[model samples]
Target: MSDYFHNKRIVVTGGAGFLGAYILKGLQDRGCGHILVPRIEDYDLVRPADIERMYDDMQPDVVIHLAAVVGGIGANREHPGEFFYKNLMMGVQLIEQARLRGIEKFVAIGTICAYPKFTPVPFKEQDLWIGYPEETNAPYGLAKKMLLVQSQAYRQEYGFNSIFLLPVNLYGPGDNFSPASSHVIPALIKKCVDARDSGADHIECWGTGKASREFIYAADAAEGILLATERYNGPEPVNIGAGFEIAIKDLAEKIV
Candidate 1:
């Protein structure tokens, strides 16, 4: 760890986002001197011209792409087209432009949702393409999965340096708790907290509580991303997690 990121001018596409916030802190902690976070309002990454403009303005030596149109199952079902199109366009265009600009490295953040619907317990990185993803969020997952394809392709063809990382369900402070699109952990916590504040005897939850998931603290996930950015340059994607899984029923009991 010779301060690989200390002097590099890094650009994080979604630097204002939940995970992006922690990534910014990680970079700062690493003594990075120049880190640019492109806000979507300022630079709409889905558009190719804006991506080029971002490159011209930031002049980054490295790029860590964390921007994505994400949501829980409900949101995914409601806006599959938007999720697929936006996430796909943003990543594809950004990576292409970054390559053309000759950025030293690119770090693409992917999702565990990209795993197959029936991936065996303790999913392995090699099982990514064993089958199609879970139907609920397949569009978003597949969209992000293309980044891996692009990363490997560009690496082999043009010698572009890029890496992909897959992080599992993320939960911690600042987690989204919106009823319309929050993930399991935050949604569960919110329900419990709201019930307690209102003095309700019980709260209702969806599903049979049979599902299982693995979550990484947002800060831990950020550190993993930064480490991969500094150290990993391989063709395969890496999984970032706590290396454990828990059942939803068990998790709910613990929260209660």
Candidate 2:
């Protein structure tokens, strides 16, 4: 890749998270130095004042907005309001502050859940607004999707350089594996591993196993984000994903 990222002062929100960790290392691999990763304890991005303080303190050349309140379907079901409010507030405040600071670039990471429930397989970027997202993930999805709106409006009104990325279900190392919070791949890995140890005949799975999803490995997703930041600049939202899909039942069977 190009050395455009060399020595740029960048801030990666949620830099300690599952995908964020890979993104951080990916940035490092791209020779990005002066990277500032704020811990939640030290910097509360949801607060406008703190966001202001961060820009004043770091004066980063770029901001990758990845911090979000997210979880599995169950967690989303239990905390829709929290998911909606926190993600909305965080993305809104951060992007606005980045604009105010005249930051050179802003990368906003969105979710696959932003797509409508019945979106055509191998979900495309243009289909994002065809209908409401699946009921279980609507709140979190809409909250992240709003970043695309924010990016467009900012570009139109102020020429702010911001890009929004929608990556499909992410898996691989560092992903959550707990039943309460894990996505499909990690959850299934845990289930299978534990079942093997426990000598179980079979494992119960969620749904009818009819639903299918596309997955982007964390490392590959990180690479895509880095490349987008370095090269892609446009108004249309982009989909970052592997061009393959899998049925949940088939995935589980393969896992076992």
Candidate 3:
């Protein structure tokens, strides 16, 4: 590890989250100190006043905006308005506040779901605005997509240094395994483990198990984020992926 971020104050909004924790670990490994993590219980990102106070207190050199209301299809469907409002408000407030505070660099994490549902396979960064996102995840996805737009605008107008990254479905340890809000990988792992423990012959999954998806380990995604922070300094968003795709059924089989 280099001293690039040594003793530099960094603030990760969702430091306790799955992907956020991995990103935090990467920053720590690079010698970062004075890391401030404000949990939702302590500070809600949706509130402008709280965000303003965080900027005043932490004064982070780099702000990684990862705090948001995230979940799978069922959760999104159940709480569409909350997902949209919380995520949109948090992102807009955090990035705008960071710009006003004159932060050195800002890293915004986008999602693949931001692309249109019918977008071409092997989705490219350019395909982001091709059409509407999938109904189940449109609100959550678009909320994050707005940050990319803000990044470009800020860079061009105010000369703010901000980069956006779109990472594919992420998994690994420390992932949320609750069936109500968990993503596919961890949910499947829990299900398989339980089924095997019960000696069940088979387990049933949703959606005909035909949809294809790309998966990235949480650690790998963090590496990509930091690498982009160090080497990539463009306004265009970069897609961090595993470079391979798999069907849902195939992925479950491999997990089992």
Candidate 4:
């Protein structure tokens, strides 16, 4: 916890959410004095007017845009348009308003889903645009990817201080466990727990079990974001991950 965040007014858009909870704890641990977390009921960020209002009310020195429309593959498939539109609108409007407000810094959190469907074993930041994202989450991925473009463009044109970070799938305590929207780890955890409680022979997992993924504990990912916010300020996007991949079958077996 450097003095970098101390005495600076901060606004974390999704400070009440899963990852957002860890972020808030980190900020408080780092001694941030004033932190604002606008609830959805109070600020519907998808609307430009609400964004403007949030800026007026919070008057944040650093804006960490983390609020997003997110879910599992089933949700993505069922509501691609909703995911794309809300995420894009929230990010674009928030970044534009932050620039206009002349904030000290803006940190935009991106998704690993933005990586192309068949990225090399070790995902590299430079290879972000080489190909299309996996089909199930493409709309959500592309919407978030736009922030990287906007961050670079804003820095180049308006000299606005902003950074984008791509974090692999995050899993840790207090993660979303709902079957309807949970990611891989939590979904698996729930299934395993339920099977054990019921004394079932086995549990069923989604997909072919051949898909591989890398995940970062939510706390570690939060810490990385705070570090990047305090120190790093470059146009190129950064990757926050554990740097290892596990096949779904292997991951499930381990969890079991």
Clashing pairs in 4: none
Please give, for residues 1-256, the per-residue lDDT of candidate 1 as tens digits. Answer: 4688778899998888889999999998889999999987889998999999989999999999999999887899999999999999999999999899889999999999999999987888999999999999999999999999999999999999999999999998888999889999998999999999999988888889888999999999999999999889999999999988999999999999
Question: What lDDT tens digits, residue by residue, belong to model 4 across residues 1-256?
Answer: 3698889999999999999999999999998889899999999999999999999998999998889999997899999999999999999999999999899999999999999999997799989999999999999999999999999999999999999999899999999999999999999999999998999979998779998999999999999999999999899999999998999999999999
lDDT, candidate 2, residue 203?
91
Q: What is the lDDT of candidate 1?
A: 0.93
The numbered model that scores best in TM-score is 4
lDDT, candidates in the order shown:
0.93, 0.91, 0.89, 0.94
> Candidate order by lDDT, highest to lowest?
4, 1, 2, 3
> What is candidate 3's lDDT per residue for 185-223, written digit by digit as tens?
988988998899999988878988889899999999999
RMSD of each: 0.9, 0.9, 1.2, 0.8
**Ten-residue segment with the worst summed lDDT in candidate 2?**
173-182
In model 2, the Cα lDDT at residue 191 comes to 90
* Candidate 1: regions farther than 4 A off: none
- Report the number of the highest-lDDT candidate: 4
**Residue 92 in model 2: lDDT:** 92
Worst 10 residues of 4 by lDDT: 1-10
